[model samples]
Target: MAKPQVRYVCQSCGSIQSKWMGQCPDCQGWNTLEQEASQAATPFANKHNLRGGGRRIELASLSSEIEPAPRRPTGMTEFDRVLGGGLVPGCAVLIGGDPGIGKSTILLQAAARIADNGGSVVYISGEEAVDQVRLRADRLGVAQSPVQLGAGTAVRDILTTLESQPAPTLLVIDSIQTLYSDQLEAAPGTVSQVRAASHELIRYAKTSGASLVLVGHVTKDGQIAGPRVLEHMVDTVLYFEGERSHAFRILRAVKNRFGGTDEIGVFEMQEKGLAEVTNPSALFLTDRDRPVAGSVVFAGVEGTRPVLVEMQALVVRVPSGATPRRAVVGWDSSRLSMVLAVLEARCGLAFSGHEVYLNVAGGLRIGEPAADMAVAAALVSALLDRPMPNDLVAYGEIALSGEIRPVSQSAARLKEAAKLGFTRAFVPPRGNSGREIATVEFPTLAALVDHLTDGL
Candidate 1:
């Protein structure tokens, strides 16, 4: 007879404790600890088993055998570009998005492409049956290829099928939360089940030299719906973020062991499917007949991708003395407040009792420091009731001392701006001197104010 094993696991952070606790020690969430069955407490059962462990071999005895990596293209150029060329073998990718965000559609399209490329692909659907998947595929007009569809949600059965198949298979789990392992007595979609299933899929991928993609759900707070450990176990994490009202969707890389974290893929949701946008800048910028106040174009970098985005700001006089509020949507509120302070201190602009609202177009968030100048310029343009010129682009970081600090990848930013036919650019003085644009170099935000006011 086997010994009875007992363990407590946090439903929030996946922290295992020998005994039950009221609060999670790691995340400090209350009542997150739950007891799992004794059979699921095996130390070696839940752990992922990768290669190159427990082998004592000399370095000199190992020969150099590096095979060229073959990337499975998705028939979408922009998607491939953001994936650092293509999906790598033995890699696990986690993609999360809101419900009805076309997460399933995108992966199914990729599976079709993989099959079209002469590669066998298996798509495991936990949310829908095989007939439902086929109906949607036919409705979307997706081509059928060497792709196999499974309707069950059992993790053990999925693993069995994967093991029975040979190499060169691309497996996609519609979601990680729906998979349940029979070895564990916990219910499906529980913290323990999610963690266990993710490990098993990762191990299967590495050992079989196959690429695996897991579609994960997001909570109402926009966080990936699973324990934090699930993210740590995966090789890459991608989040599909966009407003449901908006047609454009942005795929942002949050974690990537093989590539960059800042890479972003842009796609337009269409009736047929998600269409990749080749030139995101043009799509993001509005085609206005004339320059409008509260609008400015920002040159920023998302990983190796250079994106030009539009910033809009509105400054209105406060009706009462209750201290006007600062509201920002899509853009970071803290960063917006910091830029407002710089403008007030350096540019001598009094924004104390005014209600300020800032927005980044296309429903995308800007984390890069290069957007600071554009946000400032847009605020100033709104305050002065004059719009920035259409053919002008701006990017810089405003220091607290009122100096325009240099931003990373200035040269590349200028090149992208020029390629997009922007005739003039306002940049940091130290970094913009040798650039080709009709550059206005400013030592301080005050200098920028003086430069613009002189022409006005």
Candidate 2:
């Protein structure tokens, strides 16, 4: 028998070190290092090393015919969309979000629907009691479903009970942090325990061809709380995002092996449960009863969907010698600074003593750079006290050299804006449509500035 070697590992990043340190050198996270056992090296045998003959392995061509992995629909279109149409068999999904952001609510609803649709579902809660889960199920109107429920913390006990029952179509673990394997001396949620527990459960899921859903806890910085390897081990990773002041939640897929990544599914939080938002653009648009300065509609793409969101800007004069502050919400502040620099350097504008604030309405964050033109237009409109047309929308990317770049899915953007009763659009040069809506194409950011400041 040989003694196992001890190694220190960072819980946040899974970086191993020979000795412990107060701060992790890799991730710079403080107080995250934990002790774990390193397996001893196996002894070599003369007979095994001398053996030459071995079994041959089979190989397959790239064009070989085989049946595709079957997918089971969770009965919710929004959930299915984030999982890439449907949940593939043996797929492991990890979903993380802010506390009280409805991570459990949505999963419970989906589990009930799967049970109702003649599929077996077993929901195991490690944090909440069985009765507490039942109360939530009743509130979500899913208590009548035939879904088996249990509350436990030990991974060994959970696997033991699951081994006796027939393989279920779907298995949900409320959280991975709460399960601790008996084989390890480390506590639950530690690096070694979490890794070992996840590996064991995932191995079982693969052997049984069952889809596994793991709800993950998020840190204060909004990242999943665990070793980085947890995300890599899973087939798909999802982030449930929402503003506390907002009513809607965005389920985004950052990684998916079976489906398209960068896809988003919209859901609105209500009393009953999470309701799918079929037309999210309508909810993000502002009321057009009266045209207001510093407000412009931006035609943007969320995943494959064309969404119209309102962009607002406010420019105020700052006292001399005071550094002008730039505050932005729901959009990138660095990008806003770049747009402002182009406006001042290329468009002959003076914003030295003016404070700038920009916001994307509806609490929906806009990451696509296509909204650059709209943001620029709104800033200029606010600075000049000129209101843009209520029926006008903008979509284009602006470069530092004062050029307006064309974005992808032009037709999709224009069609969505026109359908929402926008009669005019300001987009990048070319890709115009034959619709009744008039389109003004800006070849450069200077041209956009000229139109917004001089032509207005």
CA lDDT of every candidate: 0.84, 0.91
Clashing pairs in 1: none
lDDT of 2 by residue, 279-334 (tens): 99999987789989999999998888888999999999999899999999999999
State, as a TM-score between 0 and 1, how close model 1 is to the true structure: 0.84
Using TM-score as the measure, the top candidate is: 2
Model 1: per-residue Cα lDDT over 1-456, one tens digit each? 446678899988899999987888899999999988666434475454444356686766458787767777766776676667778889899999999988898888888887887888889999999999998788667746668989778888888777787865688999899999999999989899999999988998998888999999989999999899999999889989888878899888889887778799899998888888878888878885699898989988888878888898999998766779899988889988898888887678989978999988888778877788888888888888887788898999888898888888888888888888888989887777435677777778888777666653
- TM-score against native, each model: 0.84, 0.88
With a 3 Å backbone cut-off (N, CA, C), the pairs that clash in candidate 2 are: none
How big is the positional error of residue 346 in model 1, measured in Å on the Cα after superposition? 3.0
| RMSD (Å) per prediction | 10.4, 10.6
Which prediction has the highest lDDT against the true structure? 2
lDDT of 1: 0.84
Residue 217, model 1: lDDT of 90
What lDDT score is found at residue 159 in candidate 1?
83
